[model samples]
Target: MQEARYTLDDLLTLMQVLRDPQQGCPWDVAQHWDSIVPHTIEEAHEVADAIERRAFDELPGELGDLLFQIVYYAQFGREEGRFDFHDIVHVLTAKMITRHPHVFPDGHLGSRRQGVAAVDVDTSAVGQRWEARKVNERDSRAATSHLDDIPLALPALSRASKLSSRASRAGFDWPDHRGALDKIREELAELEVEIEAGHQENMNAELGDLLFAVVNLARHLEVDPEQALRGTGQRFERRFRHVEDAVRESGHPIEHTDLDTLECHWQEAKRIERGQ
Candidate 1:
């Protein structure tokens, strides 16, 4: 027989009980905002990983883990007398409706545009309106620049992408991808010079500049730098695993393997990937 399903209230109640002082789980009672941030980020990444891997069966569990992070925050807010999960829902729903005025004509939950198909909506106009609304919201929050409010806690590559995107929106961007491509070559040359000079500090700064240039090129090419890097990492791991397996079959330690042999295996991995 199937068990009864738990609802949102059940989840909220569970969080409250787990966080209750004296009777609650010790770890849950001890947790605070700062300490939970890492767990929240990890859960979010796990959810993303599940989606990217097309693990639909695991998605529900992953999504529940991510939702629990929000519930934890909401529980903290309730304990502090500031807000709760309901408030979060209200703010998110209202903001989304306001931003998508074409769909929500009256900016209310029950309101919808009549007789207009989504395909017939002016997408460019919608985008402009959305940006205008966001700018107004930012200004009301006392933001001093278009770059304001980007979270400092974001991963470096993702943050760099956001910083460059904001700059592009402010008309500081190159005219096309060619300009961004040229920038990569320029940064590469500077990095090479720094390497030759053997100044560790200069090399580090130049390396960062080179990476930022590559990220800009990625933006121009309509690629996400973080996701692209993740994909590359996956490819590297897969091919390296193949190398390890081949080495094990030959009874050779990978440490003692020469570059020529390693390169041969790497090339074979590439060939297999290309179906050659």
Candidate 2:
């Protein structure tokens, strides 16, 4: 006999059992939505990390962990009589169907029944339509500003990119990447001035402005600033580990290594990384 494959209903049932007050795992039973928020965020980042690292073998497990976070939230909502997994699924499915007019029957691009091939559809127009639909959704919610729905809990870089995109949609953005690059230079100058003044508070604010300007530049170049920064951090770790290994081979602790010697090791690490 073939082994049975568990369906979404079975997953929901598993979550329900895990959250049962009398017989569930204590940790699972004790978790509320708020308590799981950090884990949810972490699982999301882990999924991203797996993709960034091209760890295809780990992708399924990472994705499952992220899905479990959603399941956990749905279970909490079910307990409170607010919503459930099916409600979440329903809303998501409806939203996708509503968003894809080129593919959906009621969409602007006509329907599959009209014999429109996906390859023949104008993707740029589809993207514009998607954005317009999102704006409509925002309006329906009575959002006071274009940026009103941006999540405050987003990572600073991601949030900055989103905020910039929202403002751009309102015609408040730079005309081009050149303008963004100039703004970055201007911000850097302001930061330099603050640094020279030796005022910690002003320096802090100026530095934040500088970083935000760089994020704007990244946006103009169509780069996800959060992902770019994460990639840079990974590269730094890899290079630093190479330096550490070099130091260990030299029989000296890193702290005792001279700056020039460490710099040499770093250069070597870069050369090696570049296949030089």
Candidate 3:
């Protein structure tokens, strides 16, 4: 039997049906804004993984997963008479055009169909023109006039980095990257002092401050803190799995092994992987 092939449009239609009242899939029908939020974030991470791995074949499937997440919210919104899928698309389309003034501003010579064009800005002076435009957009939307509008739900490190970078753009910044590094060192010292005093709460707070400082340092160095941490996580997973497999092969359970033994196996895994 031949399987039914579905186009992107067909999948979108299927999502609408799955979300319909009185006849929809019970599981899909039961989901709410809060319940599906995690899936949207997960799908976004999957899309990033596909891009990083150059998984061309996997890209379509991953993107479909992301599209379904969008459709789910849209369908639910439609049922409630709040908004429809078209509104979702329309708002983002308008936003993309509006933010890219080099392409969409009056007297602009480029076609809208022509994709985003690159503008070379001095890395040292990143926040002047680009950031001023962002501040204007945010001020138009936000209740407060402050430009640092980093969402509270973003991961602590990411949120801190974004907030610090925005604040720096607004002139509330360390004089230079070296000053930022000095702040990191000071935060670290404060954490160590808290640890020595056995003040768990202070230690935790200082540790957070230290990590936040590290994020600021990453921004200063023109690196993405999220991507850097993700790469480190991937590397650790790879090395740890190698150690686990090697220990299992030697007829020993991981929990039964001492730290010294585990360290030896971990070093071996690193050597093997590095061809050292």
Candidate 4:
């Protein structure tokens, strides 16, 4: 006897059953669009975390959890008479096929460009075509500002990068990374002025502006500001934990460790990380 693998149909059936009004689990029955949004965001972050941490063994499960968020939304759409999972799949497939004209010459899933390897395609042309299509799509949706389509729920650093990128495309940006670096210095000066003034509200506003300027600099350098910050956070965690462990080995609470001792352990952690 062999074990059976569940298929997409089975998953759809499971979702339908879970949302059944009369017989579904109470918690599943109680969930709605708004209630599930937080879980969707969390699942997305977990998937990113798994990838960033290079946990390939856990990637499948993390990806499945992220997929479940889509399924959950599809079920809600079904109950509200708007759409369902198949509708979502069809729209996505059709839209992608339409966008990728170089790949699908006939504007369809079944059509493919023959005798052309993907590497032979001009990436610059492809990017231009993609952006042109996106602009047309935005026009069809009556988008007024380049920034209008960006989601407010995005993490601030990522959003700042996107906002600046959009502005750059609209001819509002610095000519190069040198200009971006100069903007960071200008913002930092303003921040310092606010700090010296001891105005809490102005300081907060200036600090935000300074961080946004840094994000713009990151964009110019072709780096993701959010991912860079997350990497820094991980390094800080490793160094702090090393300090904690050293204090523990000395039979003292980390809270009671002197600043100089903690600094010594932190430096040691950095030295070890550098393979020194």
Per-residue alpha-carbon lDDT of candidate 1 for residues 1-276, written as tens digits (9 for 90 to 100): 999999999999999999989789999999999999999999999999999999999999999999999999999999999999999999999899999989988879899899989999999999999988998899999999999998998988999999998899899999999999899899999999989989999999999998998889899998999999999999999899989888888899999999899889988998899999
TM-scores for all candidates? Answer: 0.96, 0.93, 0.81, 0.96
Q: List model 3 lDDT by residue over 247-273, tens digit each.
A: 898899999978898899889877887
Q: Each candidate's lDDT (Cα)?
A: 0.93, 0.91, 0.80, 0.91
Report the C-alpha displacement of residue 86, candidate 3, in angstroms: 1.5
TM-score of 1: 0.96
Error of 1 at 110 (Å): 1.2
TM-score of 3: 0.81
User: What is the C-alpha local distance difference test score of candidate 2?
Assistant: 0.91
* Model 1 ranges with Cα > 4 A deviation: none
lDDT (10s digit) by residue, model 2, range 10-62: 98899989988898889999998789999999999999889988999999999
- lDDT tens readout by residue for model 4, 84-105: 9999999998888878999999
* Alpha-carbon runs more than 4 Å astray in model 2: 107-116
Indicate the worst ten consecutive residues by lDDT in candidate 3. 107-116
**Candidate 2 similarity to native, TM-score:** 0.93
lDDT score, candidate 1: 0.93
